[model samples]
Target: MKRNLREKTKRNIGLDLTRIFAFLSVISVHFFLNTGFYKIPLRGKRMFILATLRTSFMVCVPLFLLLTGYLVSAKKIPLEIGNLKKYYKKIIPVLLSYGIGMTVIFAIYRLRGDRSYNLQKLVFGILGYKEYSWYVNMYIGLFLLSPFLTNIWASIGDKKTHLALIAVFSLLTVGPTVFNVNDLTSLKAIFAAYDDNKINHLLPGWWYNIYPLTYFFLGAYLRTYVDFKKLRPAKVFLALILIIFASSAYNIWRSHGGSFQIRLWNSWGSLQNTASSICVFILINTLAPERVNEKIERFLAYISKLTFAAYILSALSDKLVYSFVNANLGSVKESMPYLPIIILSSATLALAMAAGVEFLTEKILEKSVREK
Candidate 1:
């Protein structure tokens, strides 16, 4: 019993590592995007390294969704009124924190003469609008639809149901990319518009619905069907190879004509990104070795627990950091060389601030909640 318990703990720890890595990847992406780091020319090797990091980090969002599906689905947390209540209790704080935090950031920006607001932007931001906020919105939708989605999984059973759902999801994922009709309402077009206009688009409201439902169902299906015990070393290697080749090929193709927009469209698809995420998932599950997995798992568990706080604080930090740097250093376009340093410094500072805030919230604020 002792040995078995130790082994189980080890495995959970390994899973946590992968999760932390995913979050770090997210941080890296945001760092690059908000800063102009990727634009720098670092001769040949450095340029190649930065490019690889940028491309690989793109998997962060999909990996996050996949993990969400895996965890929630595997736990088989039944969706009920009680569950909904609990979910709202958990999510409401995040939404409220994000709103108040962003509002302050926006107000500061406006004061600095960064006038990019209108009624639409204000409405959307209040409603958790903007690109980075999509995950929050998506999760909210998932929580709201959890009962229906879980029921669908429960009714369908494992094999037939997951397969059927994947098939439908595949169509939903790919259909928008291939066909475009202005008169018709395409999921792809909506997602695209959201990407282009951020809060300015009405279509994001629709696309946000797809994130949680699709991911929740996918997670539930995977939890029901995928058997880590059945996996072998050879199969794991093959999956890894496939993920590498596919991701590399796709990245290369994307380099020619792809942009963030294309990647966003392909995010929901079970193509390279999905394959990569699953491969990492499988690799972590079966062959993570013991020590490495334990370390990663512990770190990720910490980060995952604090992810909501990190996200909220990170956004606020990014805006503030960006505004401060831009103001002090002049326009980023002109201060290109200093951009990377500023972004990195700002991210570090933001992460530290987030950690501090989380400590207070959990220890002090949460204690107050318990007392109440």
Candidate 2:
């Protein structure tokens, strides 16, 4: 048992790093959002550098989506009635965590002087949209469908067909978004004539929002078929570096050093976003050492488990840190040089506070659950 546990740890340490970095990316992305990075005009070499960080960090959520699909694919959960209860039970803790996080965010909002929120508002907020927890809505839909999706994955025995499915999904979800005039900042759209009405109707993008499934299915496909053992880690790393630059460079050119929208198409379906994500996801899974240090493994694993909570809890960190910084540290542009410090401070504070809440939440969840 010990040998098996150690082996699992070695293999998963890379994923642990993935989770940890992904969570950090979430915090960093919020740094841009909360620090007024988006409200200011983006241009010049400095903005390009910041854009690169934004591009790189944007892959965090995609990495998690891919990880979900990959991990789910590795398990053989059929869509049978017998397996339904066991599979669905995994969601109890997620729901509980979200509830706790949501209440905290709503409470903080009230304390921030939004007195319009009452118990009724809080109750409505549970079923409705809450801050920093949009991912929860997307995830719940994906989670409910995973069993059927994985079963569909199992049915597709042909590699060619699987690739074709991914291509189609990408084309519909990512292709139009990356090339349409409706979104002028996209690479192809940036080069072409700018016309909001001149959309590429040939490639209908009505289905672009299904990108969560795209990432999920791609994750499962990579896990099920790709032979990462055969690929050179150096080559993959080089490709990832190039993709990040290509992505950031395009955004820089489009911005023209003024009136640029950094968050536009920064969604999961962006080409650079998708490209960076797949590349990093592949590299991480491929390049991990066979035997990681046990202590490092434990640390990585512990922090990784708290990632979701840290992420949910960042609603508070973002509020508190930025509130203080915006008040004392000067304007967002003026504080550009100190971006690293600001983000680090917020992330550290969030993770520290989330650690205790997460532990207690887990214990409560454990007791609340009754085995059949």
- For model 1, what is the C-alpha lDDT against the true structure? 0.58
Question: TM-scores of the models, in the given order?
Answer: 0.67, 0.89
lDDT of 2 by residue, 1-372 (tens): 999876664646678878888888888888778767776677666666777888788888899999999888777887788898899989987787777777777777888799987888878877875767788889999998898888888889899888888898898888866655354446676465335565545477788889988998899988888777677889999999998888777766666555445533556777878888988887877886656677877777888887887888898888888888888886666666888888888788778867776777888976766541
TM-score of 1: 0.67
Q: Across residues 1-372, which tens digit of lDDT does each residue of candidate 1 receive?
A: 998887765646545656656666666677556656544443444444444555556666666676666665544445667866765575655665556545555665577787886556766776856636767766666666665666666767558656877767655653443332122355554334223333222232333325445555666665777776578867777876766555555444434323322344344443555556666666666665545545665665666566555665566667767766667765434545564575566556656665665665556557767899
Candidate 1 local lDDT, residue 46: 40
Show model 2 residue runs off by greater than 4 Å.
1-11, 108-114, 182-195, 262-265, 369-372
List ranges where model 1 is wrong by over 4 Å.
Answer: 1-11, 35-52, 75-83, 96-126, 175-212, 229-270, 289-300, 316-348, 363-371
Top TM-score hit: 2
